[model samples]
Target: MKFRKVTETDVAKIVEMIADDELGKTRENYQIPLPTEYLIAFENIQADPNQELIILENENFEIIGTLQLSFIQYLTYRGRIRAQIEAVRIRKDKRGFGIGKKMFEWAINRAIERNAHLLQLTTDKKRQKAIKFYEDLGFKATYEGMKMHF
Candidate 1:
Protein backbone atom coordinates (compact mmCIF):
# COMPACT_ATOMS: atom_id res chain seq x y z
CA MET A 1 0.00 0.00 0.00
CA LYS A 2 1.17 3.53 -0.72
CA PHE A 3 -0.05 6.99 0.21
CA ARG A 4 0.49 9.96 -2.05
CA LYS A 5 -0.94 13.38 -2.78
CA VAL A 6 -3.69 13.40 -5.38
CA THR A 7 -3.19 14.42 -8.97
CA GLU A 8 -5.86 16.12 -11.04
CA THR A 9 -6.64 12.95 -12.97
CA ASP A 10 -7.32 11.06 -9.76
CA VAL A 11 -10.24 13.21 -8.69
CA ALA A 12 -12.93 11.13 -10.36
CA LYS A 13 -11.78 7.90 -8.75
CA ILE A 14 -11.56 9.59 -5.41
CA VAL A 15 -15.10 10.79 -5.76
CA GLU A 16 -16.24 7.33 -6.76
CA MET A 17 -14.91 5.77 -3.58
CA ILE A 18 -16.52 8.48 -1.51
CA ALA A 19 -19.85 7.86 -3.20
CA ASP A 20 -19.79 4.09 -3.04
CA ASP A 21 -21.43 3.69 0.35
CA GLU A 22 -25.00 4.37 1.46
CA LEU A 23 -24.49 7.72 3.17
CA GLY A 24 -21.93 8.87 0.63
CA LYS A 25 -24.27 7.92 -2.19
CA THR A 26 -26.59 10.63 -0.97
CA ARG A 27 -24.00 13.39 -0.66
CA GLU A 28 -21.38 12.90 -3.37
CA ASN A 29 -21.69 13.52 -7.07
CA TYR A 30 -19.43 10.95 -8.71
CA GLN A 31 -20.25 10.90 -12.36
CA ILE A 32 -17.99 11.07 -15.34
CA PRO A 33 -17.19 14.49 -16.72
CA LEU A 34 -17.30 15.53 -13.08
CA PRO A 35 -18.60 18.97 -12.23
CA THR A 36 -16.19 21.89 -12.51
CA GLU A 37 -16.57 22.52 -8.81
CA TYR A 38 -14.60 19.38 -7.99
CA LEU A 39 -11.60 20.60 -9.89
CA ILE A 40 -11.89 24.02 -8.37
CA ALA A 41 -11.92 22.54 -4.90
CA PHE A 42 -8.96 20.33 -5.81
CA GLU A 43 -6.98 23.34 -6.93
CA ASN A 44 -7.73 25.14 -3.71
CA ILE A 45 -6.57 22.21 -1.63
CA GLN A 46 -3.48 21.63 -3.76
CA ALA A 47 -2.42 25.21 -3.33
CA ASP A 48 -2.85 25.25 0.43
CA PRO A 49 0.15 24.19 2.49
CA ASN A 50 -2.15 23.23 5.37
CA GLN A 51 -4.27 20.85 3.31
CA GLU A 52 -3.33 17.43 2.02
CA LEU A 53 -5.64 15.46 -0.26
CA ILE A 54 -4.29 11.93 -0.27
CA ILE A 55 -4.77 8.91 -2.47
CA LEU A 56 -3.96 5.37 -1.39
CA GLU A 57 -2.53 3.09 -4.06
CA ASN A 58 -1.98 -0.59 -4.36
CA GLU A 59 1.09 -2.35 -5.76
CA ASN A 60 -0.05 -1.59 -9.30
CA PHE A 61 -0.59 2.05 -8.40
CA GLU A 62 -4.37 1.74 -8.59
CA ILE A 63 -6.18 4.19 -6.34
CA ILE A 64 -7.85 2.18 -3.59
CA GLY A 65 -8.57 4.87 -1.03
CA THR A 66 -8.57 8.61 -0.45
CA LEU A 67 -8.70 11.16 2.39
CA GLN A 68 -7.97 14.75 3.31
CA LEU A 69 -5.80 16.00 6.14
CA SER A 70 -6.04 19.55 7.36
CA PHE A 71 -3.61 21.22 9.74
CA ILE A 72 -5.37 23.85 11.77
CA GLN A 73 -3.69 26.59 13.79
CA TYR A 74 -5.92 28.15 16.42
CA LEU A 75 -5.58 30.22 19.60
CA THR A 76 -6.54 27.32 21.82
CA TYR A 77 -4.07 24.98 23.57
CA ARG A 78 -1.34 27.61 23.48
CA GLY A 79 -1.62 27.75 19.68
CA ARG A 80 -0.72 24.10 19.14
CA ILE A 81 -1.40 22.59 15.75
CA ARG A 82 -4.37 20.33 15.25
CA ALA A 83 -4.55 17.72 12.49
CA GLN A 84 -8.04 17.06 11.19
CA ILE A 85 -8.86 14.08 8.99
CA GLU A 86 -11.83 14.17 6.68
CA ALA A 87 -13.48 12.65 3.61
CA VAL A 88 -11.94 9.27 4.36
CA ARG A 89 -12.91 6.50 2.00
CA ILE A 90 -11.57 3.12 0.92
CA ARG A 91 -12.58 1.37 -2.26
CA LYS A 92 -15.33 -1.23 -1.87
CA ASP A 93 -12.89 -3.94 -2.88
CA LYS A 94 -10.30 -2.76 -0.41
CA ARG A 95 -12.40 -2.88 2.75
CA GLY A 96 -11.68 -5.48 5.48
CA PHE A 97 -8.03 -5.71 4.44
CA GLY A 98 -6.44 -3.66 7.22
CA ILE A 99 -5.45 -1.03 4.66
CA GLY A 100 -7.67 1.51 6.38
CA LYS A 101 -5.86 0.98 9.66
CA LYS A 102 -2.56 1.40 7.92
CA MET A 103 -3.86 4.58 6.37
CA PHE A 104 -4.81 6.00 9.77
CA GLU A 105 -1.42 4.98 11.09
CA TRP A 106 0.11 7.00 8.30
CA ALA A 107 -2.05 9.96 9.21
CA ILE A 108 -1.00 9.70 12.85
CA ASN A 109 2.64 9.67 11.87
CA ARG A 110 2.06 12.59 9.58
CA ALA A 111 0.41 14.58 12.38
CA ILE A 112 3.39 13.82 14.58
CA GLU A 113 5.76 14.87 11.83
CA ARG A 114 3.89 18.14 11.51
CA ASN A 115 4.26 18.72 15.25
CA ALA A 116 0.53 18.60 15.75
CA HIS A 117 -0.61 18.39 19.36
CA LEU A 118 -3.73 16.40 18.51
CA LEU A 119 -5.23 14.38 15.68
CA GLN A 120 -8.98 14.58 15.26
CA LEU A 121 -11.76 13.48 12.93
CA THR A 122 -15.54 13.59 12.80
CA THR A 123 -17.49 10.78 11.23
CA ASP A 124 -21.18 10.69 10.52
CA LYS A 125 -23.11 9.03 13.31
CA LYS A 126 -24.76 6.82 10.72
CA ARG A 127 -21.41 5.26 9.95
CA GLN A 128 -21.21 2.99 12.97
CA LYS A 129 -18.41 0.90 11.56
CA ALA A 130 -16.19 3.85 10.95
CA ILE A 131 -16.75 5.13 14.46
CA LYS A 132 -15.82 1.75 15.90
CA PHE A 133 -12.74 1.57 13.73
CA TYR A 134 -11.62 4.94 15.00
CA GLU A 135 -12.26 3.92 18.57
CA ASP A 136 -10.17 0.81 18.08
CA LEU A 137 -7.37 3.05 16.88
CA GLY A 138 -7.34 4.76 20.30
CA PHE A 139 -9.59 7.73 19.61
CA LYS A 140 -12.09 8.66 22.27
CA ALA A 141 -15.52 10.20 22.01
CA THR A 142 -14.78 12.95 24.44
CA TYR A 143 -17.29 15.45 23.19
CA GLU A 144 -20.55 15.64 21.34
CA GLY A 145 -20.18 16.96 17.84
CA MET A 146 -22.80 19.25 16.36
CA LYS A 147 -22.96 20.62 12.87
CA MET A 148 -25.19 23.01 10.98
CA HIS A 149 -25.59 22.37 7.27
CA PHE A 150 -25.87 25.41 5.14
Candidate 2:
Protein backbone atom coordinates (compact mmCIF):
# COMPACT_ATOMS: atom_id res chain seq x y z
CA MET A 1 0.00 0.00 0.00
CA LYS A 2 1.07 3.56 -0.68
CA PHE A 3 -0.12 7.10 -0.10
CA ARG A 4 0.00 9.78 -2.80
CA LYS A 5 -1.64 12.80 -4.33
CA VAL A 6 -4.56 12.15 -6.62
CA THR A 7 -4.22 12.23 -10.37
CA GLU A 8 -6.89 12.62 -13.05
CA THR A 9 -6.71 8.92 -13.76
CA ASP A 10 -7.75 8.13 -10.22
CA VAL A 11 -11.08 9.92 -10.57
CA ALA A 12 -13.20 6.86 -11.26
CA LYS A 13 -11.92 4.89 -8.31
CA ILE A 14 -12.14 7.90 -6.08
CA VAL A 15 -15.74 8.46 -7.08
CA GLU A 16 -16.56 4.85 -6.34
CA MET A 17 -15.20 5.10 -2.84
CA ILE A 18 -16.89 8.44 -2.13
CA ALA A 19 -20.21 7.34 -3.55
CA ASP A 20 -20.26 4.37 -1.20
CA ASP A 21 -19.74 6.51 1.85
CA GLU A 22 -21.88 9.00 3.79
CA LEU A 23 -20.67 11.67 1.40
CA GLY A 24 -22.67 9.92 -1.27
CA LYS A 25 -25.80 10.56 0.76
CA THR A 26 -24.98 14.23 0.72
CA ARG A 27 -24.45 14.11 -3.00
CA GLU A 28 -27.75 12.35 -3.48
CA ASN A 29 -29.52 15.46 -2.25
CA TYR A 30 -28.06 17.37 -5.16
CA GLN A 31 -30.29 17.58 -8.21
CA ILE A 32 -27.41 16.78 -10.53
CA PRO A 33 -24.08 15.68 -9.14
CA LEU A 34 -21.06 14.41 -11.02
CA PRO A 35 -18.71 12.60 -8.70
CA THR A 36 -16.00 12.47 -11.32
CA GLU A 37 -16.00 16.22 -11.55
CA TYR A 38 -15.85 16.47 -7.79
CA LEU A 39 -12.78 14.30 -7.77
CA ILE A 40 -11.18 16.51 -10.40
CA ALA A 41 -11.86 19.56 -8.25
CA PHE A 42 -10.23 17.82 -5.31
CA GLU A 43 -7.12 17.36 -7.42
CA ASN A 44 -7.20 21.01 -8.35
CA ILE A 45 -7.47 22.04 -4.72
CA GLN A 46 -4.54 19.80 -3.84
CA ALA A 47 -2.48 21.33 -6.61
CA ASP A 48 -3.05 24.74 -5.11
CA PRO A 49 -0.34 25.72 -2.62
CA ASN A 50 -3.00 26.57 -0.04
CA GLN A 51 -4.68 23.18 -0.06
CA GLU A 52 -3.91 19.46 0.12
CA LEU A 53 -5.64 16.11 -0.29
CA ILE A 54 -3.98 12.73 0.16
CA ILE A 55 -5.15 9.41 -1.23
CA LEU A 56 -4.39 5.86 -0.18
CA GLU A 57 -3.83 3.18 -2.79
CA ASN A 58 -3.16 -0.51 -2.68
CA GLU A 59 -0.68 -2.66 -4.58
CA ASN A 60 -3.02 -2.59 -7.58
CA PHE A 61 -3.00 1.20 -7.57
CA GLU A 62 -6.65 1.40 -6.61
CA ILE A 63 -7.70 4.36 -4.48
CA ILE A 64 -9.05 2.64 -1.40
CA GLY A 65 -9.20 5.62 0.95
CA THR A 66 -8.87 9.42 1.00
CA LEU A 67 -8.49 12.46 3.28
CA GLN A 68 -8.39 16.22 2.86
CA LEU A 69 -5.99 18.44 4.75
CA SER A 70 -6.65 22.16 4.78
CA PHE A 71 -3.97 24.45 6.14
CA ILE A 72 -5.43 27.19 8.28
CA GLN A 73 -3.73 30.32 9.58
CA TYR A 74 -5.08 32.07 12.63
CA LEU A 75 -4.28 35.44 14.18
CA THR A 76 -5.38 34.60 17.69
CA TYR A 77 -2.79 31.88 17.89
CA ARG A 78 -0.06 34.29 16.85
CA GLY A 79 -0.07 33.19 13.21
CA ARG A 80 0.20 29.56 14.16
CA ILE A 81 -0.97 27.12 11.50
CA ARG A 82 -3.04 23.97 11.71
CA ALA A 83 -4.23 21.26 9.41
CA GLN A 84 -7.97 20.52 9.40
CA ILE A 85 -8.52 16.95 8.35
CA GLU A 86 -11.76 16.08 6.60
CA ALA A 87 -13.67 13.56 4.50
CA VAL A 88 -11.65 10.60 5.69
CA ARG A 89 -13.14 7.55 3.96
CA ILE A 90 -12.10 3.95 3.61
CA ARG A 91 -13.88 1.58 1.28
CA LYS A 92 -16.58 -0.32 3.14
CA ASP A 93 -15.03 -3.70 2.46
CA LYS A 94 -11.63 -2.46 3.55
CA ARG A 95 -12.76 -1.18 6.95
CA GLY A 96 -11.49 -2.72 10.24
CA PHE A 97 -8.15 -3.63 8.70
CA GLY A 98 -5.95 -0.79 10.02
CA ILE A 99 -6.46 1.23 6.83
CA GLY A 100 -7.81 4.19 8.79
CA LYS A 101 -4.89 4.12 11.20
CA LYS A 102 -2.38 4.08 8.37
CA MET A 103 -4.17 6.79 6.47
CA PHE A 104 -4.40 8.96 9.60
CA GLU A 105 -0.70 8.50 10.25
CA TRP A 106 -0.01 9.68 6.75
CA ALA A 107 -2.21 12.73 7.28
CA ILE A 108 -0.36 13.53 10.52
CA ASN A 109 2.97 13.16 8.72
CA ARG A 110 1.74 15.36 5.91
CA ALA A 111 0.71 17.98 8.44
CA ILE A 112 4.14 17.80 10.07
CA GLU A 113 5.77 18.20 6.66
CA ARG A 114 3.75 21.36 6.14
CA ASN A 115 4.62 22.70 9.61
CA ALA A 116 1.07 22.47 10.93
CA HIS A 117 0.63 22.77 14.71
CA LEU A 118 -2.51 20.66 15.04
CA LEU A 119 -4.58 18.11 13.17
CA GLN A 120 -8.33 18.02 13.60
CA LEU A 121 -11.41 16.31 12.21
CA THR A 122 -15.13 15.97 12.99
CA THR A 123 -17.48 13.03 12.76
CA ASP A 124 -21.24 12.75 12.98
CA LYS A 125 -22.58 11.52 16.28
CA LYS A 126 -24.16 8.47 14.71
CA ARG A 127 -20.79 7.15 13.66
CA GLN A 128 -19.84 5.75 17.03
CA LYS A 129 -17.16 3.50 15.70
CA ALA A 130 -15.56 6.35 13.82
CA ILE A 131 -15.45 8.47 16.98
CA LYS A 132 -13.79 5.62 18.81
CA PHE A 133 -11.29 5.16 16.03
CA TYR A 134 -10.25 8.78 16.14
CA GLU A 135 -9.87 8.63 19.90
CA ASP A 136 -7.77 5.50 19.57
CA LEU A 137 -5.55 7.46 17.21
CA GLY A 138 -5.04 10.07 19.92
CA PHE A 139 -7.55 12.59 18.56
CA LYS A 140 -9.52 14.27 21.33
CA ALA A 141 -13.19 15.19 21.24
CA THR A 142 -12.49 18.81 21.67
CA TYR A 143 -15.44 20.84 20.43
CA GLU A 144 -18.89 20.05 19.15
CA GLY A 145 -19.30 20.62 15.43
CA MET A 146 -22.55 22.25 14.46
CA LYS A 147 -23.79 22.71 10.91
CA MET A 148 -26.99 23.98 9.37
CA HIS A 149 -27.86 22.18 6.18
CA PHE A 150 -29.36 24.63 3.81
Candidate 3:
Protein backbone atom coordinates (compact mmCIF):
# COMPACT_ATOMS: atom_id res chain seq x y z
CA MET A 1 0.00 0.00 0.00
CA LYS A 2 1.07 3.57 -0.67
CA PHE A 3 0.00 6.77 1.01
CA ARG A 4 -0.14 10.17 -0.62
CA LYS A 5 -1.78 13.55 -0.38
CA VAL A 6 -5.34 13.55 -1.66
CA THR A 7 -6.15 15.08 -5.02
CA GLU A 8 -9.37 16.64 -6.16
CA THR A 9 -10.17 13.54 -8.17
CA ASP A 10 -10.03 11.39 -5.04
CA VAL A 11 -12.77 13.29 -3.21
CA ALA A 12 -15.60 11.20 -4.61
CA LYS A 13 -13.98 7.95 -3.56
CA ILE A 14 -13.21 9.37 -0.15
CA VAL A 15 -16.80 10.41 0.28
CA GLU A 16 -17.97 6.96 -0.69
CA MET A 17 -15.59 5.34 1.74
CA ILE A 18 -16.89 7.53 4.55
CA ALA A 19 -20.50 6.91 3.62
CA ASP A 20 -20.19 3.14 3.34
CA ASP A 21 -20.20 2.48 7.10
CA GLU A 22 -23.15 2.34 9.52
CA LEU A 23 -22.24 5.53 11.39
CA GLY A 24 -21.43 7.29 8.16
CA LYS A 25 -24.74 6.33 6.61
CA THR A 26 -26.44 8.74 8.97
CA ARG A 27 -23.87 11.49 8.55
CA GLU A 28 -22.76 11.50 4.92
CA ASN A 29 -24.68 12.34 1.78
CA TYR A 30 -23.38 10.90 -1.48
CA GLN A 31 -26.38 10.86 -3.74
CA ILE A 32 -26.49 11.54 -7.46
CA PRO A 33 -26.14 15.26 -6.96
CA LEU A 34 -23.05 15.53 -4.81
CA PRO A 35 -22.76 18.23 -2.21
CA THR A 36 -20.74 21.34 -2.96
CA GLU A 37 -19.71 21.61 0.67
CA TYR A 38 -17.42 18.63 0.22
CA LEU A 39 -15.62 20.24 -2.65
CA ILE A 40 -15.36 23.52 -0.79
CA ALA A 41 -13.95 21.76 2.25
CA PHE A 42 -11.48 19.85 0.13
CA GLU A 43 -10.26 23.07 -1.45
CA ASN A 44 -9.88 24.71 1.94
CA ILE A 45 -7.93 21.75 3.29
CA GLN A 46 -5.65 21.74 0.29
CA ALA A 47 -4.91 25.42 0.78
CA ASP A 48 -3.97 25.07 4.42
CA PRO A 49 -0.32 24.33 5.08
CA ASN A 50 -1.04 22.83 8.46
CA GLN A 51 -3.70 20.49 7.18
CA GLU A 52 -3.04 17.27 5.34
CA LEU A 53 -5.61 15.01 3.69
CA ILE A 54 -4.14 11.69 2.75
CA ILE A 55 -5.33 8.81 0.62
CA LEU A 56 -4.07 5.24 0.77
CA GLU A 57 -4.01 3.09 -2.33
CA ASN A 58 -3.09 -0.47 -3.14
CA GLU A 59 -0.91 -1.85 -5.91
CA ASN A 60 -3.72 -1.40 -8.40
CA PHE A 61 -4.03 2.27 -7.43
CA GLU A 62 -7.45 1.79 -5.90
CA ILE A 63 -8.25 4.10 -3.06
CA ILE A 64 -8.68 1.96 0.03
CA GLY A 65 -8.26 4.30 2.97
CA THR A 66 -7.99 7.94 3.95
CA LEU A 67 -7.24 10.19 6.94
CA GLN A 68 -6.54 13.80 7.70
CA LEU A 69 -3.81 15.17 9.90
CA SER A 70 -3.52 18.69 11.21
CA PHE A 71 -0.55 20.27 12.89
CA ILE A 72 -1.27 22.90 15.52
CA GLN A 73 1.28 25.12 17.18
CA TYR A 74 0.17 25.70 20.73
CA LEU A 75 1.56 27.57 23.72
CA THR A 76 0.92 24.57 25.92
CA TYR A 77 3.48 21.75 26.34
CA ARG A 78 6.19 24.36 26.23
CA GLY A 79 4.97 25.60 22.86
CA ARG A 80 5.36 22.29 21.18
CA ILE A 81 3.35 21.53 18.09
CA ARG A 82 0.82 18.72 18.12
CA ALA A 83 -0.49 16.53 15.30
CA GLN A 84 -4.16 15.64 15.37
CA ILE A 85 -5.48 12.79 13.29
CA GLU A 86 -9.07 12.84 12.09
CA ALA A 87 -11.48 11.53 9.47
CA VAL A 88 -9.80 8.16 9.38
CA ARG A 89 -11.64 5.60 7.28
CA ILE A 90 -10.68 2.39 5.57
CA ARG A 91 -12.78 0.61 2.98
CA LYS A 92 -15.22 -1.71 4.77
CA ASP A 93 -13.91 -4.69 2.80
CA LYS A 94 -10.31 -3.84 3.67
CA ARG A 95 -10.46 -3.89 7.44
CA GLY A 96 -8.45 -6.37 9.60
CA PHE A 97 -5.67 -6.66 7.05
CA GLY A 98 -3.17 -4.56 9.03
CA ILE A 99 -3.85 -1.56 6.80
CA GLY A 100 -5.02 0.52 9.74
CA LYS A 101 -1.92 -0.33 11.67
CA LYS A 102 0.25 0.64 8.74
CA MET A 103 -1.72 3.84 8.42
CA PHE A 104 -1.14 4.79 12.06
CA GLU A 105 2.51 3.96 11.81
CA TRP A 106 2.75 6.23 8.78
CA ALA A 107 0.87 8.97 10.61
CA ILE A 108 3.23 8.71 13.58
CA ASN A 109 6.25 8.93 11.36
CA ARG A 110 4.69 11.96 9.67
CA ALA A 111 4.03 13.59 13.04
CA ILE A 112 7.62 13.09 14.02
CA GLU A 113 8.78 14.48 10.71
CA ARG A 114 6.72 17.60 11.32
CA ASN A 115 8.34 18.02 14.71
CA ALA A 116 5.09 17.47 16.53
CA HIS A 117 5.55 16.67 20.21
CA LEU A 118 2.23 14.92 20.59
CA LEU A 119 -0.11 12.92 18.39
CA GLN A 120 -3.78 12.64 19.24
CA LEU A 121 -7.20 11.58 17.98
CA THR A 122 -10.71 11.10 19.34
CA THR A 123 -13.13 8.34 18.39
CA ASP A 124 -16.86 8.28 19.02
CA LYS A 125 -17.90 6.63 22.28
CA LYS A 126 -20.11 4.28 20.29
CA ARG A 127 -17.16 2.87 18.41
CA GLN A 128 -15.94 0.31 20.90
CA LYS A 129 -14.02 -1.68 18.33
CA ALA A 130 -12.16 1.42 17.20
CA ILE A 131 -11.35 2.29 20.78
CA LYS A 132 -9.80 -1.10 21.33
CA PHE A 133 -7.88 -0.82 18.10
CA TYR A 134 -6.46 2.47 19.26
CA GLU A 135 -5.54 1.04 22.64
CA ASP A 136 -3.70 -1.75 20.92
CA LEU A 137 -1.79 0.96 19.09
CA GLY A 138 -0.62 2.42 22.44
CA PHE A 139 -3.07 5.29 22.69
CA LYS A 140 -4.24 6.06 26.22
CA ALA A 141 -7.75 7.22 27.10
CA THR A 142 -6.51 9.79 29.55
CA TYR A 143 -9.22 12.41 29.15
CA GLU A 144 -12.92 12.67 28.50
CA GLY A 145 -13.88 13.80 25.03
CA MET A 146 -16.87 16.10 24.92
CA LYS A 147 -18.42 18.00 22.04
CA MET A 148 -21.47 20.00 21.09
CA HIS A 149 -22.99 20.22 17.63
CA PHE A 150 -24.20 23.54 16.45
Candidate 4:
Protein backbone atom coordinates (compact mmCIF):
# COMPACT_ATOMS: atom_id res chain seq x y z
CA MET A 1 0.00 0.00 0.00
CA LYS A 2 1.20 3.52 -0.83
CA PHE A 3 -0.10 6.85 0.44
CA ARG A 4 0.08 9.97 -1.70
CA LYS A 5 -1.59 13.28 -2.29
CA VAL A 6 -4.89 13.00 -4.16
CA THR A 7 -5.22 14.06 -7.80
CA GLU A 8 -8.16 15.62 -9.62
CA THR A 9 -9.10 12.23 -11.06
CA ASP A 10 -9.28 10.59 -7.65
CA VAL A 11 -12.08 12.79 -6.35
CA ALA A 12 -14.93 10.56 -7.50
CA LYS A 13 -13.38 7.43 -6.03
CA ILE A 14 -12.75 9.27 -2.80
CA VAL A 15 -16.32 10.48 -2.73
CA GLU A 16 -17.55 6.98 -3.39
CA MET A 17 -15.67 5.66 -0.38
CA ILE A 18 -16.82 8.54 1.78
CA ALA A 19 -20.42 7.83 0.84
CA ASP A 20 -20.18 4.09 1.43
CA ASP A 21 -20.87 4.38 5.15
CA GLU A 22 -24.21 4.89 6.88
CA LEU A 23 -23.53 8.44 8.07
CA GLY A 24 -21.82 9.34 4.84
CA LYS A 25 -24.75 8.11 2.79
CA THR A 26 -26.75 10.94 4.33
CA ARG A 27 -24.22 13.63 3.45
CA GLU A 28 -22.13 13.02 0.34
CA ASN A 29 -23.32 13.27 -3.23
CA TYR A 30 -21.21 10.75 -5.12
CA GLN A 31 -21.91 10.33 -8.81
CA ILE A 32 -20.44 9.57 -12.21
CA PRO A 33 -19.53 13.22 -12.36
CA LEU A 34 -19.17 14.60 -8.87
CA PRO A 35 -20.69 17.98 -8.07
CA THR A 36 -18.49 21.01 -8.63
CA GLU A 37 -18.26 21.77 -4.91
CA TYR A 38 -16.06 18.75 -4.23
CA LEU A 39 -13.67 19.74 -6.98
CA ILE A 40 -13.64 23.31 -5.71
CA ALA A 41 -12.89 22.08 -2.18
CA PHE A 42 -10.16 19.87 -3.56
CA GLU A 43 -8.62 22.82 -5.30
CA ASN A 44 -8.80 24.87 -2.13
CA ILE A 45 -7.19 22.08 -0.13
CA GLN A 46 -4.47 21.67 -2.74
CA ALA A 47 -3.69 25.35 -2.58
CA ASP A 48 -3.18 25.34 1.19
CA PRO A 49 0.41 24.56 2.20
CA ASN A 50 -0.73 22.93 5.44
CA GLN A 51 -3.44 20.76 3.90
CA GLU A 52 -2.80 17.24 2.70
CA LEU A 53 -5.62 15.42 0.94
CA ILE A 54 -4.19 11.91 0.88
CA ILE A 55 -5.25 8.75 -0.90
CA LEU A 56 -4.14 5.18 -0.24
CA GLU A 57 -3.32 3.05 -3.25
CA ASN A 58 -3.10 -0.70 -3.40
CA GLU A 59 -0.63 -2.69 -5.50
CA ASN A 60 -2.74 -2.27 -8.60
CA PHE A 61 -2.75 1.52 -8.02
CA GLU A 62 -6.43 1.62 -7.15
CA ILE A 63 -7.69 4.14 -4.66
CA ILE A 64 -8.61 2.14 -1.57
CA GLY A 65 -8.78 4.80 1.10
CA THR A 66 -8.48 8.52 1.72
CA LEU A 67 -7.96 11.03 4.56
CA GLN A 68 -7.38 14.73 4.99
CA LEU A 69 -4.63 16.04 7.27
CA SER A 70 -4.30 19.64 8.23
CA PHE A 71 -1.44 21.20 10.11
CA ILE A 72 -2.79 24.01 12.22
CA GLN A 73 -0.57 26.67 13.70
CA TYR A 74 -2.33 27.53 16.91
CA LEU A 75 -1.72 29.67 19.96
CA THR A 76 -2.25 26.99 22.53
CA TYR A 77 0.35 24.43 23.65
CA ARG A 78 3.00 27.12 23.52
CA GLY A 79 2.22 28.09 19.94
CA ARG A 80 3.03 24.63 18.69
CA ILE A 81 1.56 23.08 15.59
CA ARG A 82 -1.39 20.69 15.77
CA ALA A 83 -2.27 18.17 13.12
CA GLN A 84 -5.98 17.59 12.56
CA ILE A 85 -7.20 14.56 10.66
CA GLU A 86 -10.58 14.50 8.95
CA ALA A 87 -12.74 12.64 6.42
CA VAL A 88 -10.99 9.30 6.77
CA ARG A 89 -12.59 6.58 4.73
CA ILE A 90 -11.56 3.13 3.60
CA ARG A 91 -13.32 1.42 0.71
CA LYS A 92 -16.15 -0.89 1.75
CA ASP A 93 -14.33 -3.96 0.47
CA LYS A 94 -11.10 -2.86 2.09
CA ARG A 95 -12.51 -2.68 5.58
CA GLY A 96 -11.07 -4.91 8.38
CA PHE A 97 -7.84 -5.53 6.46
CA GLY A 98 -5.69 -3.38 8.79
CA ILE A 99 -5.67 -0.65 6.15
CA GLY A 100 -7.11 1.93 8.50
CA LYS A 101 -4.42 1.22 11.05
CA LYS A 102 -1.68 1.66 8.52
CA MET A 103 -3.31 4.78 7.16
CA PHE A 104 -3.37 6.29 10.65
CA GLU A 105 0.21 5.22 11.27
CA TRP A 106 1.19 7.11 8.17
CA ALA A 107 -0.72 10.16 9.29
CA ILE A 108 0.93 10.07 12.71
CA ASN A 109 4.37 9.82 11.18
CA ARG A 110 3.60 12.63 8.80
CA ALA A 111 2.45 14.78 11.69
CA ILE A 112 5.68 14.07 13.50
CA GLU A 113 7.61 14.96 10.38
CA ARG A 114 5.80 18.30 10.30
CA ASN A 115 6.75 18.87 13.97
CA ALA A 116 3.17 18.90 15.16
CA HIS A 117 2.88 18.94 18.92
CA LEU A 118 -0.33 16.94 18.81
CA LEU A 119 -2.59 15.02 16.47
CA GLN A 120 -6.35 15.34 16.80
CA LEU A 121 -9.50 14.00 15.13
CA THR A 122 -13.23 13.89 15.70
CA THR A 123 -15.67 11.13 14.83
CA ASP A 124 -19.43 11.18 15.14
CA LYS A 125 -20.64 10.03 18.54
CA LYS A 126 -23.04 7.63 16.91
CA ARG A 127 -20.20 5.60 15.43
CA GLN A 128 -19.52 3.33 18.34
CA LYS A 129 -17.23 0.95 16.52
CA ALA A 130 -15.24 3.81 15.10
CA ILE A 131 -14.87 5.27 18.58
CA LYS A 132 -13.51 1.96 19.82
CA PHE A 133 -11.12 1.75 16.91
CA TYR A 134 -9.73 5.15 17.75
CA GLU A 135 -9.43 4.30 21.43
CA ASP A 136 -7.48 1.22 20.45
CA LEU A 137 -5.12 3.49 18.60
CA GLY A 138 -4.39 5.43 21.84
CA PHE A 139 -6.77 8.33 21.43
CA LYS A 140 -8.42 9.60 24.59
CA ALA A 141 -11.93 10.97 24.75
CA THR A 142 -11.04 13.65 27.24
CA TYR A 143 -13.21 16.48 26.04
CA GLU A 144 -16.97 16.63 25.56
CA GLY A 145 -17.40 17.97 22.09
CA MET A 146 -20.28 20.10 20.87
CA LYS A 147 -20.87 21.44 17.40
CA MET A 148 -23.35 23.77 15.74
CA HIS A 149 -24.29 23.16 12.14
CA PHE A 150 -25.81 25.83 9.99
Residue-wise C-alpha lDDT for candidate 2, range 1-150, written one tens digit per residue: 998877766655666666676657667322224445575586678678867767888899777898778898887577888899987889888988999999988889988998888998878788898888889999998788899989
lDDT of 4: 0.95
- Give lDDT tens digits, candidate 1, residues 1-150: 789999999999998888899998998888899988899999999999999999989999999989899999989999899999999899998899998998999999999999999999998898899899999999999989999999
Regarding lDDT, does 2 or 4 come out ahead? 4
Q: For model 1, what is the C-alpha lDDT against the true structure? A: 0.93
Candidate 3: tens digits of C-alpha lDDT, residues 1-150: 899999988999999988997889999998655699999999999999999999999999999999999999999999999999998999989998999999999999999999999899999898999999999999999999899999
Model 4 worst lDDT window (10 residues): 25-34
* Collision pairs in model 4: none
Q: How much is the lDDT of residue 38 in candidate 2? A: 70
In order of appearance, the predictions have TM-scores of: 0.98, 0.85, 0.97, 0.98
Per-residue lDDT of 1-150 in model 4, one digit per residue for the tens? 899999999999998998899999998898887999999999999999999999999999999999999999999889999999999999888899999999999999999999999899999999999999999999999888889999
- lDDT values, one for every candidate: 0.93, 0.79, 0.95, 0.95
Off by over 4 Å in 3: none
